[model samples]
Target: MTPSNQRCSVAIIGGGAAGITAAAVLRKRAPQLSVTIVEPSSTHDYQPAWTLVGAGEYDVATTRRRLKAVLPAGVSLIQQRAHSFEPTSNRVQLEDGSILEYEQLIVAAGLQTNWQLIDGLVDTLGKNGVCSNYSYDTAPYTWECVQGMQNGRALFTQPPMPIKCPGAPQKILYMAADHFKRKGRKVELGFCNAGPAIFGVPFYAKALMQVVKHYGIATHFGYNLVAVNGPGKEAVFETTVDGMKIRHIEKFDMLHVTPPQSAPDFIKNSPLADAAGFVAVNKHSLQSTLFPNVFALGDCAGTANSKTAAAVRAQAPIMVSNLLALRMGSALSAQYDGYASCPLTTSVGKIILAEFGYDGVVMPSFAADPRKPARRYWHLKKRFLPWLYWNQMLMGNTGPDWHAKREYPDTLPSISP
Candidate 1:
């Protein structure tokens, strides 16, 4: 087959955390290897800070920066959307009818936020008290909705599992509840979770449940939001019990919706994906099982780890080390332990930093008991982490060494073998 387009030594499919980190590391470690980043966005967002932004504690502007500013020197940026992958020819097809050939491919294009999955959601989002922190555009509106409400029914909904930052859906709820309490507002707050549990890990779940009780939030397990009528201030939910599906309608004065998410359609439909539509890769190595030269990280990879930026931070180095080693015809020694961290902000001044790996093994980074809420953790979440993300992580100066050694069982079977 004939091809017409540009060529590079390495072509990264995304400019997000994973792609940027990989590029930064490659630039530093392998200077002669030409690199080009294909991304559609002009700005990069530090999404972890959006929870605080929604709570009116942090300014939204600080969470975003020009993508050019963060990218490493000597790395090329192609500000275009990738339409498809041609692995056999080692080429990527762009939306603008351009093709890029590469010696190796790294797919870090994060998940897609499917707001359209919920009926009437797209038209009403960021208006009529319907807000979502999942978006940079709508997050500020969440603060607006939170500020104007004196006290009524506030519903925070969590869609199914595998969403990025699983704790974020509830973290914002805690922020809103704390805000309402401080203002002496009488509000009926409800947390509608599509999943059956409060938290995935039991150690952290106990502490979170206490915070949930303190806020007097009614919990609805197995409830999934299916539709929203923003003008009417009504929401529709679906649930299953004993193999029977049920529908429930609830009225809300305010709604914070975490829309459903999945791997981007281009990656899902490509030959790189598994049955689940994620790029099929060896969970530990981050290398594509189908294609040796292809690697994936962040939300789009079918890894068993929680889809947090922390997971990507832990994953980037290993992916790069192994990738470079493969290029040198050396043995690949890097293996990811499925590390992920979730800073569960219990309140404004307190947080329970939940760090764990495969199979929910409690991995605490500090000497203090991770089960209890600590103000120090709050400081780390509010101030330190954002700085680290911008200065160290995206620049490829960080690794999983900061992750706390798992204090739990050694013999426990991990989610992956």
Candidate 2:
């Protein structure tokens, strides 16, 4: 069974931001340890750019690179999809029926887009005015729809809880409104969200409401999209509060759907997953609760953090440090506070960067007031974030905290919504 390749100290299951960063950190900390990353796709996508792409600001190719180009130089690459896991044998089962055993494991196979969950959505998406920002191919379709329409209900839906980038639903809505405003063709915009609040954090919620007011976006909280009649240009939304009385059917010229998302099915069904579905790991260490040798990060883990690339940068080193701590027989001292960032793009040039930690705590890294919308934060998001993401974070150079030394003003002022 063991015919070709040599065993590695760590086997990474996905080559996305979390998987790649984990590999980079592991190699940096333990140069002698063998590491390999198994990923199926050759194209590496910077998913944060999806927003800009939909806004007609960036193209799809601008956010992508060859997968091999970003991987650590010395690490072996297995360009294959993991079909299943055999944790009992410490082996990963690939689609080609090959076996790769390892000393430790890290699974970062990010969220899956369940486009088929809504009726007729699968056949109609990326065509016929039914588009989504979640897909790389369909992001431009959103812009095309925006450019093509001036009237009619432009419906944007946020699926149920636990989707990646929770604020993404609202972000797209604001951007779309801005596009219409700039074109001088005002369109009726409706936000149908599954949650009751615009945002999890109250400080940012206040700021978002102002943008909503300026753009005249109608909010229908507690509304979840259940069906899509794309050919007929209609979307069905069910009310969470009043299931029977509030069922509403509306026709739309454009629909921007943030599809329902979840941890990869294989990882969720395995022993590593907890009851609710997600790799069961200690929130602080990012290590498997049952098996100490296994670790998980990104959208796949049960860490009580918002899933974003910004969070992955904060999580990678902690997971790496803990894994190395195990190899060196040292007590694990590093901890992750569920730090995650969401750059809420309210306009083409402005962003309300919401940085928070465990339990939705607003942990701003910059000293500027959290309530005020400043150009500096937007500049950081536009100018510095990509550099920090590709050069510093993915390169395994982000130091711990990157936030610990920051001091935001508490006395400047506070805004309540």
Cα-based TM-score, every candidate: 0.95, 0.94
lDDT of 1 by residue, 42-81 (tens): 9999999999999888899999999999999999999999
Q: List the residue pairs that clash in candidate 1.
A: none
Candidate 2, run of 10 with poorest lDDT: 408-417
Clash number for model 2?
0
| The candidate that achieves the highest lDDT relative to the unseen native structure | 1
Stretches > 4 Å off in candidate 2? 1-6, 242-246, 399-401, 404-417
Q: What is the Å distance of residue 405 in model 1 from its true position? A: 3.4
Q: Give the alpha carbon lDDT tens digit for every residue of 18-63 in model 2.
A: 9988988888888898898999999888888887788887778878
